[model samples]
Target: MTMKKLERFALIAMAALGAAACASVPTYVSLDPSLPRAQLTFHKGYEGTGLFSSAVQNYALGADEYCDSAKHAALFKNVSGTESALRVTPDVRTVVWAFTTYLNSTIGAGGVLGRYDDCRNAVIFTPARNRNYDIRQASTNGDAQCSLVITDAATGAAVRNVEVRASPDCIPRTKAARGSNR
Candidate 1:
């Protein structure tokens, strides 16, 4: 490739990397009192509040990327969120993924390349029961914060609480019990 073309390519690649570094990552924390299995239904998106509500648009949930054993059931309609469900196994422990989007601007040389900034914030949480869940975002010192709330489907009492923070990275947890009813 010509030197000029190569230089431009290098610059674009660097810009992409920079954007990814700022993307949000989701973390999964396993709650105690393990059950054989459970169903998980959650909504992912900005809660339509705060200063950057509009800024934080088009949030996507990548289940397969973070949820090792997560199976996409269906998508429910939310005023400003995407809903999904996953059937989890006892072997899985932590579910991890990132919430990311591109930044766009109309004022400058980057206008043609309007969408330039990569925005991703890390979110981590655990499952408490097989029921409906609500996830919302909070603005903490300009950075978007994530919160998860799970409630019992029958009684409407809170079951598991989701928190956003940095934690030791983990992969899918699986176990094989050997012993027989034979």
Candidate 2:
């Protein structure tokens, strides 16, 4: 396989682990009424998968820096804001998003074992107090290229001075954390 294929495999594997971690996902902090706060509504519009396959996507919110995958173990919500909105303290925050599309090994459909492709990206910005923001992302060229948008909810305008950047290279998790016991 080419280098590109390896990258995709790493990401897909990570997202798959995250999916399992979601069963006992981490808990988000409650908003402190004393501190300034803002609301975020996440939007999901991923590339559709082929028939007989499944897709999984989630986001992780980290404060004051790009999401270090090593630090974030579980991926959060996959549903859009129509279900619920995220409340956060107003500060420099990073929204890390990722998704995986996979076909399970099965008896039918020319199965030669399972295969998958995945991508991850993030947006970092400081949200205004008491404002509502809509966040969305998309990827192309087999996860090589991507973009994220943050728009003002009331006016439907893109947030000014926003930064949308592709995710950095994946860093492997520590062995002890993975239950090596070595």
Candidate 3:
């Protein structure tokens, strides 16, 4: 590679790292019982684990990037893991998207690329306080299609008043505008 290309790559990588640092949100830890909360489980299916696929090892819940600058401090994002269940305050909208693809990259000179042949599913919903919700992401049709399911973790019952969607869309939350400079 040329020196110019290397410098450009470094700059892009640094910018991405900086952005990631700025977007960081503390992981959910329900230490206080007094706080209104709900437990959630995140699951991700890896259809293509090799190159060309996204580097997203886990999906996140909550607005890690913040809904608006006005609610900057209110950001909450927890990545998927089996280490433990995550806690979420009721009434907060959550979005999760999983990339499932059968179009994995091949090795060698004859290797080709998959053009928009990937599969994915996204969901958005609000949890009830003190409830246990399970959010599962799945893929089918040779990983060409994706699916999402949110339900009670214990009873296996479908959650009420919640929408399970094939694509994600945040049901915009309202927060009063903060003070502005005079």
Candidate lDDT (C-alpha), each: 0.38, 0.53, 0.48
lDDT of 3 by residue, 116-170 (tens): 2444455567777778877665553234455667778878997766555633432
Quote the RMSD, in angstroms, for model 2: 9.0
- Candidates ranked, most accurate by TM-score first: 2, 3, 1
Please list the residue runs of candidate 1 whose C-alpha ends up more than 4 Å from where it truly belongs after superposition.
1-36, 47-81, 90-92, 107-182
Predict model 3's lDDT versus the native. Answer: 0.48
C-alpha lDDT of candidate 1 relative to the true structure:
0.38
Clashing pairs in 2: none
User: TM-score for all predictions?
Assistant: 0.39, 0.60, 0.52
- State the displacement of the C-alpha of residue 8, model 1, in Å, after optimal TM-score superposition: 21
lDDT of 2 by residue, 1-182 (tens): 44455445545654665557454335456477677788877665455433323345555566433223323322332222222356777765554444433333223455334555556666567878899888765543245455666789999999886766544333344666546522
Candidates 1 and 3: which is better by TM-score? Answer: 3
Q: Provide the lowest-lDDT 10-residue window in model 3.
A: 69-78
For model 1, give the 10-residue run with minimal summed lDDT. Answer: 50-59
Model 1, range 1-182, lDDT digits (tens) per residue?
Answer: 44455445444544554344334433333334365545555545433322111233222233333333332222221223465544444333334333333333233443323333323443444544454344332222233444334554566666544343354222343443112211
